[model samples]
Every structure is written in C-alpha cells, then in structure tokens.
Target: MRSSMTIVHAPQSDIKMIPSPILTQVESFQHWKNDIIRDIARYRAWLRDNVIYDQRVDKELQLIQARLRDKTLSIAFVGEFSRGKSELINALLFPQSEQRLLPSTLGRTTMCPTELIYEQCSEPYLKLLPIETRQEALPLKHLKQQEDRWLHIPLDINDSKELQNTLSHIGDTKKITVEEAELLGFDCQFLESSSDAHVYVPTWRHALINIDHPLLRQGIRILDTPGLNALGCEPDLTFNLLPDCQAIVFLLNVDSGVTATDMQIWRDHIGQLQDRSATNLFAILNKIDLLWDDFADDEEIKQSVKKMKTLTAQQLNLEESAIFTLSAKQGLHARIKGDEDLLKKSNIAQFETLMFESLIDKKEQSLRKNAIEKTIFLLGNTKATLQAQLKQLEADNRSVIAMLNQGHGEMKSIAQQAKRDQVVYQNQIIALKASKQAIAKQVNTLLLSVNQDHFSTYLETTRTNFKESWSSIGIRESIAHFFTCLESDFTHLEIETNTTIKIVWSIYDKVLANSKLTHNANDDNHPDNTDSNIDKNIDRNIDRNIDRNIGNTIDSNIDNDINNNWDSHSSEQEHDLDLVQPTEFRIFEFNHSLAGLKTKATQYQKSFRSLLSGQRKSTHHFFNSVAAEAQQIHQAAHVEAKAWADGLLIPLIQHATSRKLLLDQKVKVFKALAETNKSQRQKQQELVQFQASIQLQFEDINLMIQSVSQKRPQQSFYESLKLKSTPISSEPQVY
Candidate 1:
C-alpha cells in the first residue's frame, strides 16, 4: 500500500509540509470573504440611504452579510466511534504536537460533540455544557446564551500533558438511573426495554476545544462528533449545522473498509444531498497502516487498497478519485519526529496536495456563486422597485400632458360662458344674502327683548316658571331647525351643478350639431365642401360621446376614491356633528360673578346680545362656505364637461386665446418637474448598465447551474430564484 501510494506522489524537492493548502485556502477565502462583505456593505448602505426596505429582503441581505463577516468554513468530521476521526483532524491541524491534541486512540469513544476552534492571543481552554440541558430540548447554541450553565476550564499552554488530560475528559461519561435518563427527555420506555441497570450518558452535550493552532487561526472550524449515536440524538446537528458545512470528512478504518454504520451515515447524512460536490463531500480511508500485511508483497496490498477504494466509491455514490486512503497515525508520528520518508510512506502527501490545490479553489467558487447571486438579487430588486416607481411617475407626466393638450380649446368656452354665469349666479347670491340678512335681523330683534332673554334665568327658578318660559325657549328650537336647513345647501349645490352641467352639454350639442348644416344650400358637390361637412359631423358625434362617457367615468372615480375603508358612516357623522350639534338649540345661560336674580337677568340680556353677534358672524361663515362650495362643485363639473366638449370645439370660436399666458406658465411648471427628474433618469440608465454587467457576472458564476443543465441562459438567473422584473421592453437586451 505504501509503495503504491508513494509511486503516485509528485517529486518532493520543493514540498514544504507546514504551511499546507488548508492554510493557503483560508487566506484565499479571507480575501473572497472580505470582497463579498464589502459588496454587501455597499449594498446595505445604499438601501438604507434610499429607504428601500422589506422585512424578508433586508433580513436575507443582513444574514448573508453576517455570514460573510464570520468567514468560518466548518468541516464536519463524521465516522463511527473510534474511527480515527479526531486523529485525522489532529494530523490535518496540529501535526507537530508531541502529545495528542484531541482524544484519539484504539478504544476511546468520544462522548460529546466537540468543536475545535482557534482564538488569537488567547490561552488554550476547554468549555463544556452540562448533560442536564438535554431535557430542555434546546440546542447548545441556545444554551450558550446563559454562561452560568457552562463549565469553562482554562488550559496551561506550555503544559501539553495537562492539556491532554483536560481534553481526554471529552470521552468521559457518567452512569445515570432510568429515572434520571427520563428527566433528560430520553424515553423511559425505550431504556426500560434494554436490560442495563443504569444508563451511561454523556456528561456534556457539547465541548469547545479552543487552541492556538495555525489552521484554526486562519478561520478553520472543525466539528468532531461522536459519529453514530450522537448524530441520532442531535436534531440541530442533523438539520441546521451540518447542512451549512463547507466540507464533511467521512473517516473510515482501512482494515474494516465501509462498515454498515458508515454506509448508513453517508446515505442518511453525508450523501443525503448532492448540493455540495463530492470534492467537498470527502471520505477518508484512514488507518491505512492496519492494511499493511508484512507477510504479503506490495502487489497484494495494492490490490486490496484498489478494491476498497472502488467499493467505497460505489457505496457512497462518489467519484473514486475524490476518496483518499492514508495512515493518520504514521503521518502524525512523522510530523512529531521530522521524518520526511515516514510522512511520504503514510500516503498523506496526495491528500495534502489535493487540499492545497483544490479545497480553497472549490470553496471560493462556491462562496462566490452564493454571494454573487444574493447581491444581484437584492440589487436587482432595488433597481426594479425604483424603476417601477419612476416609470409610473413618467407615465403620469405623459398622461397629464396629453390631458392638457386635450383642453387646447377649453378656456375660450369658459370665457364665453363667464358672462352668462355671472348674471345668473349674481342674482342667486343676492337673494341668498337678502334671506340671510332677514334671519340676522330677526335674531338681533330677539336678543334685545328682556322677556325672551330672561326665559333661561327664570327656568332655574321653578317648574311653573319653566312651563311659562317654554314659548321663549322656542327661539332655541327655531335656531336648531335653521342649521338643519343649512345642511340642505350642499344637496342644493349638487343639484345646481347637475343642472348647470346639463345646460352646458345641451348648449354644446345644439351649436356644434347645427353649425355646419347652416353653411350652404347647394353645397352637395365639390370634394372640399363634402369633406368639411363630414368633419363637422364627426366632431359633433365625438364631443357628444366624450361628454356622455366622461360623466360615467367621474361617477366611477368618486365611487372608488371617496370611501376611506373604515366606518362608512364615520365621515358623514363627523361632518354632521361639525355642522350642527355644538351650535344647535341650547338654552342660553349667563355665567357671571353676580348673586341677585335681577343682576343675573341683566347679565343674561348682555349675554344674549353677544350670542346674537356671534350667530351673525357664524351666519356669515356659513353662507361663505356654502357659496364657495357651490362654486367649486360647479367648477369641477365644468372641468369634466369641458374636457370632453373642448375636444370637439370649433377652434375659431372656442380656442383658449384668453389663457395663453396661463397655459405657458403651466408648461413651465411641468417642464421644471421634468427637469428635476433627470437625475433619476440618469440613475435609471446607470442601473440598466449595471444590470448588464451583473448579468455577465451571473454568467461567470453560473457553473453550479451548468453542472445540472447546459442549455440554461443568463436571462433565467432571476427566473430560477423565482424573482421578477418589470423590464422596459422597448430596449433590446444583448447576450
């Protein structure tokens, strides 16, 4: 086996063993990780400043950024108990240690899931979580929040024996009763089914071996699990932690080959998903020294290893080239003693070369693919959202311009109607003012009358006085009825607007319909004359339909927009309360600093005078509101009617000649807004160019998808992730 492995080795003239690819890749990955972090940070800042926010989207970006910053590539070492799993990790990381850094021997079975990590400028330590936490059904991660539950033992860095003694405790276990096991959330029925008097349980759920190792310092995180039963009991490891791992080193004893348990572990855990390639899903045939049959020749050992490799590959459904057979014990011994020939004989050189050559390269590509996708997705979404809003704003601008252009002949028609409207509205307003004046005079007359003013004063005197003063109190009742009548003004105005709109339409239809007919008596021939009549007829019909359909459209708009989606009656009730309740019929009581009834009565008269003055002022406000509201309703109706009517108006009579300056001013306002939007337009252009560049980036990192199917196009990048884009279809996309 040694000779066969050594024959495949590269010439070692320049091979230095200490700074391996494990460290090399870590450095490469750090750069890649930093670049991704910078990309995400830039994106995060842009999103914050732009106020682009979504709960899911922002959170996803935040998580990716955090993962990039963490930069720890977790390599899970999986195998059955005592399969030299820890030994391989020690050989890979701490090759020069004279003593065993991790618990690895022929008979030792690790009791807990251990995490071997490195911390800069810190002494070595072993942190253990209690076995009692199993009952909480909580992961070690959650229990980590409470520091009191953990036992943290500091290790003396210079004392290797002391460190080994403390680390050896990771394989220690305690015997507990069936009742105690039940308390730990273990099913008592299953334990009782077994014949054991007391169940042996791990003293710790997880262990953290913090050491100052070179590879560990380079952000290498090693997960050393007690492979078989530990994996079965731990749900978090099976689902969350293990799935995110960059690599899983499945170790097997070379003498035993692929055991039934090893195949089960691969099938159920390691080989469950092909998401990570076989290169990352590694299977190590360790303890190859056990395969050394000193009695047999080199050919026999080579044939045995070849058969084992082929069978392991078939069972794990992995490429044979991805698997490696090595003597971890021999390699560790060589590293400790500086024995180069012994290290080469261990068959670890090829594994080291593979690690140094491809581990980081593959990891970098995988990391880049994930990072680029996330960045592109988030940035694409932001660009899409901004683009969508911008497009709508632009569309609105165009619509307004088109509508304004539709009103080219409107103001002339309004100017023509102004004279007629002035005469009619002036008469109606005059009558309204006169009616209001009479009500004021009546109220003024009532204020000065002492008999009416003293009604509230006597009302508190006796029940008999109240009955007698009820007639005077009828003044308050009349005031209440007046407000009710005032609310009818809104209804009256709506009716007035309806009538005015009808009259305008009637006038427009009559004139435009009749104008061309009155042109000539014998104008049946001459192509121009015939064309003129046809044009006039088309104009009349178009304007009439525009008027007819627009009313329905406005009615539809009001129905859709006016409802605030709360209590349908809340708005009406609020409006009714404002117009009525406070001012409505209440007996006037004079509050003063006098004691006598006569003094109060005199004060009551003064109060009544102020009340009358306030009511007159209120009446002025009331009339003004009603008058202004009526004018607005009519103006709105005219706008709706004119929008249609003006479209077909004879330019000679209905052109907006009087309002050219006003129209020009409106143009300038719109032009200013359009000018301000230029920056957003520039951003939009840049975003599109950015999209193309990112699209090319998508093409570069799209290997994972290509691994499945080659026919996929770059356009399907977002489609695969189920993202959408509102593309400006007018612009063609280049491949």
Candidate 2:
C-alpha cells in the first residue's frame, strides 16, 4: 500500500533562543513593564524627597504597579479531541524534551480544561477540582479561592516523564449512572456506551498546572481545553474563559476537514472571536503528516496542504493568511532529535511565528494603552505642577526685585496684598473640602442604588414567584423577569452615576476656578491668563450648566462586546458584530460579569428536564448559583464605588494644596523682604540661586517622564521567518 517514512535522528541540542515568538514578546513586554515600575518608584521617591508627595497619587501608582506585576498573557487552544491540541502545546513549550511534557496521546487525553500557569508563591504541582463540585452553588472562580477543596499533587520538575505521567491523570474518568451524568451537566450522547446504565465522566472538573517554566514564569498562560462536549457542558468555558482569552488557537485535523461538530464549536465559541479586535484568531489544520502520501511527490503534498488550509480558512470565515497547517507530532519528534530538515518540514516554526506575531501586536497595543498611556497622563500632571511652582517662584522673585527698586512704600503694599490672598486661599480650601464631602454623600447614595440587600430581595421575590407556579414556563419567566430587573437596575445606576460624575466635576471645576483667580490676581507676571474667563458665574444655576455640558463630560464607556449572549439554539450566524473597544468603567466590568451569569442562567433554564416538583434539586442548584454570583457582584461593585468615591476629590485636593503651599511661600517671601534687614544685593543673589535650583529640578523630572514614556523596540520574529504565501495551482487540487 504505502512506503514507510524514514527517521533521521541527530544529537538533541538545547534550544538556544526563546522557543516561541510569543515568549520573546512577553519577555520584552515584562522587562519594559519592570522598567516603567522602577521609574515610577524613583519618581515617587523624588517627590517625597522634594516635600511634594501626594498620598493619593502615590496610591494610584501603587495600584498600577500591582496590576503590572499580576498581569498575565493567556492563550487558549480550542478544538475537538484528537486534533493535536495538546501535542502542539508540548511542541511549543518543551521542544527539546524526549517525551511529551503534557499528556498528549491517542484518543481523549485532556478530559477537562487545563490551565498551565506559574505562581511564584506555590511549588510545582497539579491542582485539580473534583467533578462533584459541579453540584456546589458557587462559581468556579469562588471555588478556586478555597484551596482545601482542590486535590493537590506535587510535581517533580526534574523528571519530565514523571510530570507527564502525573498530568495524564487529567483524562482520568469514573463510571457514573446516567442520572448522575445528567445532574452533573454531561451530555449522555457523548458517553462511551449509550446502551449501558452507567457512563464515563471526567474525574476532575478543571485542572491547574503550576510550574516554573520560563515562559509561564514570565506570565504566559496556556489553556488546553477539551472537546465540544466539554465546551457545552461547562458554562464557564463558554461564558468566562473563552471570552477572556486574548488569543484562541482553533485546531482542526487536516484529514477530517471541518465536520458538523467542528462547525458547531466554531459558531458557538471560536467564530464570535473573529469580531473581537483584542483577540487574535488562528485556525490550525494540524496532523498534516497524515496527508504525506508515499505515492505523491513533494509538490503534490504541498498543494494538498495548501488546499486544506484554504478550505479551512473559508469554512472558518477567516483569511487564508490566518490559517496555518502543521504536524505537531512530527514537530515534536523533529525537535527531540534536533533534525533541522524534519523540523522545517513539520511547519511548526512558521505557524508559530505568524500566529504569535499577530498575537504580540495586539498584546503590545493593549499594554501601551493601559500602562504607557495612563502613566504618561499621570506624570504629565506632575510636570504641570512643577511648572506651576516654577512660574510662581519667578513671580515672587520679580516682586522681591521690585521691592529692592521701589523701596519701603511698595513693600508695605505688597505685604497687604499677600495677606488678602492668604485669606482667599483659606476660604477656597474650606469650600473645596465641603464640595468633597458633598460628592462623598452623593456617591454613597449612588451605591445604594446597587445594594446587595436590594438585589437579594429581588432574587427572593423571583424565587417565590417560581415556587408559586411549579411549571417550567413559570421558572423560565421568573428568571427572565429577574434579569430584566437586574438590567433595569444597572441602567438606572448608569444614569445616576453619570449625573454624579458631572456634579462632582462641576464642583471641582468651580473650586479650581476660584483658586486660580486668587493666584492669578496676585501673580501679575504669570503667563496664560486663561483662568480669567473660566465661567465667573459659579453662583448661577449649576444644574443647568451641568445639563449643558453633559456631552463634554467623561462618560464611563464600557466594553459592550465582551459579554454578547451565546445563542446555542440559533443556527443563524450574527453578522452584526462589535469589537472590544477601549473604555474605562468599573461598573461596566461589573455589568459584564452579570452578563456571564445571565448566560449561565439561560443555559440552565434550557436544560430543565421536568417541572419544579420533579427537578427540585436541579432548580434549587441553578437558582442558588445565580443568587451567589449576584451577591458577589454586588459586594465587588460596592467596593469599587466606595474606592471611587474616596478618590473622587484626590486630584483636585492635591492640586489645590500644592497651589496653596506656593501661595503661602510667596506671602512669607514678601513679608521677609518687607520687614527684614537683609541687604538688596544678598536678596538678589538668593533669588538667582533659587531660580537655578528650580530649573535643575524641572530638568530632572522631565527626564524621568521621558524615560517612563520611551518605547522599547522589539524585533518581529515573523518577518525573520520570511514565510511565503500559499501556492495555489491553476487547476483544482484535492487530497
């Protein structure tokens, strides 16, 4: 029938360079983030040394630093079983190893979704949650925090074979009754034996692989998912994990092509990602070595592979350029033997380079927006403060020189003017503090609009309604009404929050205008007299002004696309799609979290097999999970709202305090010159030295700001690969 392929083995060599382009980019991004953190630390120290430290700003920097340290780049591999998903991960992560790093073999190797990550606090181990925990009324996220609930197995990193053997337990299964399977959310149709009374189910619901791999240590997380059945059974996979992943690698077998099950998986899970700009999608036609025919020449094999890739791209509705063909098994073997020619033939390197290049581009842009842009904006404010101080100093210096020329008469007038400005500054400080209190009260009122107690009441009312009528329609309608109320609550909260933000902004702006008027009135030499026209009508109707300026107000926009409803029953593909747009809002995050819960509820409602009397346990479990998730969301939203309210006046207060300090210094300087016996020449020399000192400080801060904003140049590995476009023949080619 077919000629055997020969294996040419060479001495295995260690991977000298970073194994993957994604790893390279992650390393660069991590280093750049560290550098920025170091710069921020230095800037904070400098501020403290200069006696200009703002506690509020320092807290914000601390929060940013924490986020940078905790940030992770996650990639998910999705496909049916036997698609070489696990094999591809092994080839990518442990190329030099003689055996597979993960359990990648024939049949369903990964029965549960496995996440490979690194946590420095924990030793190398495998943490697995029992499948029975599915009956728990808490979300997986909540369950993860309960360490005792997971079965921990320590991993021996020194032995790759031992590690692989241990991970193979992810596919461990147990025979359970069909009733139990259905109760645990398993589709019995996928069971090994439909005629049997019992079915095989995954022993573990989820897997966490924590290791000290270089890539994982640098915050690169790999999510190895199960087949289509698992995707449908686990709501977290569809609603939470899939949506959160930045890149999804959808694998398909070249020989099998795209089957109905594959299309279903794509439409329900991976297809929607095509609309997400933040997420990079790649359809991989794996196991290409299966198509390597002994009867065919090299050109014919290439043509076959190219045709498969093109068809896969069309099937997935992705560009051909985004579809890659490779043989993970061959790639792993090639790497282990250090056979360069075999590795090239495997096409793994080419696929990795292109896929990671696209992923890295998106990742870098996100980092730039969240870290670089926000840091620059904050530093810009500090720079503005320094410049303002310099200007005030120069103005004070000029007044001193004026006193030296004009004599005692002008000095007395200047002293009187400084005292009047001091009184005005004190009044403005009290007014700003009052405004801060007012906003705090308003934010407290706004938080009450989303209170946990209120949500619990609504949930209880729905449960009561459902219990009154024991039909499926009653429960479904009750759930729908609950969600409708929930959505209405957030809609009302959004409106109230916007109003509060505008009111808070108006009060701060008015106080700032008053403070500026005082400073400008005193500093005759000050440049930019823009504050003179800053709506001197603060006593006018504030509500009318807020309404007029609502459009200009910073609306807390959200990522509406992150939580699109997954309609599994609807076969029609949704052509109208929205990308994940950039926006900042804690409420939106909370809102999206609710969207996932709503999706879970919808799935649960559809899964109802009987009336409430017949399926009381299932119905109760569903409602309990929803209620728990709702309570958690409420608590989290409360915390965010409280923090927001606390920080609302921080920037304004910091600015006002800095300006007040400068004003006080000016008043003291004027008094000292007016009442002192110091000679004119000495005063002039002191002024000159002060001006030089301010200039030096300004230059140092400017350099620090630049260092924080400087971009790190990362070389693109995809370009280095020089991959050619797929060659299509004039005539049709088929395998």
What is the per-residue lDDT of model 2 for residues 71-182, given as tens digits with 9 covering 90 to 100? 5778999998889998899888864333456776667888899999989998999999999887766677778899999999999967655665677788887888988877
lDDT for 385 in candidate 2 is 56
Q: How many residue pairs clash in each candidate?
A: 1, 0
Model 1 — TM-score against the truth?
A: 0.47
* Top TM-score model: 2
Which runs in model 2 stand beyond 4 Å of their true positions? 1-22, 95-99, 159-164, 194-197, 229-232, 271-278, 293-307, 317-321, 353-373, 395-424, 461-472, 512-637, 664-682, 717-735
lDDT of 1 by residue, 395-504 (tens): 53455444445743222222222222222222222222222322233233322232222333332333233224334344333433333332233344344334333333
State TM-scores per candidate: 0.47, 0.78
RMSD values, in order shown: 29.3, 10.4
Q: Who wins the lDDT comparison?
A: 2
**Given candidate 2, what's the lDDT at residue 708?**
81
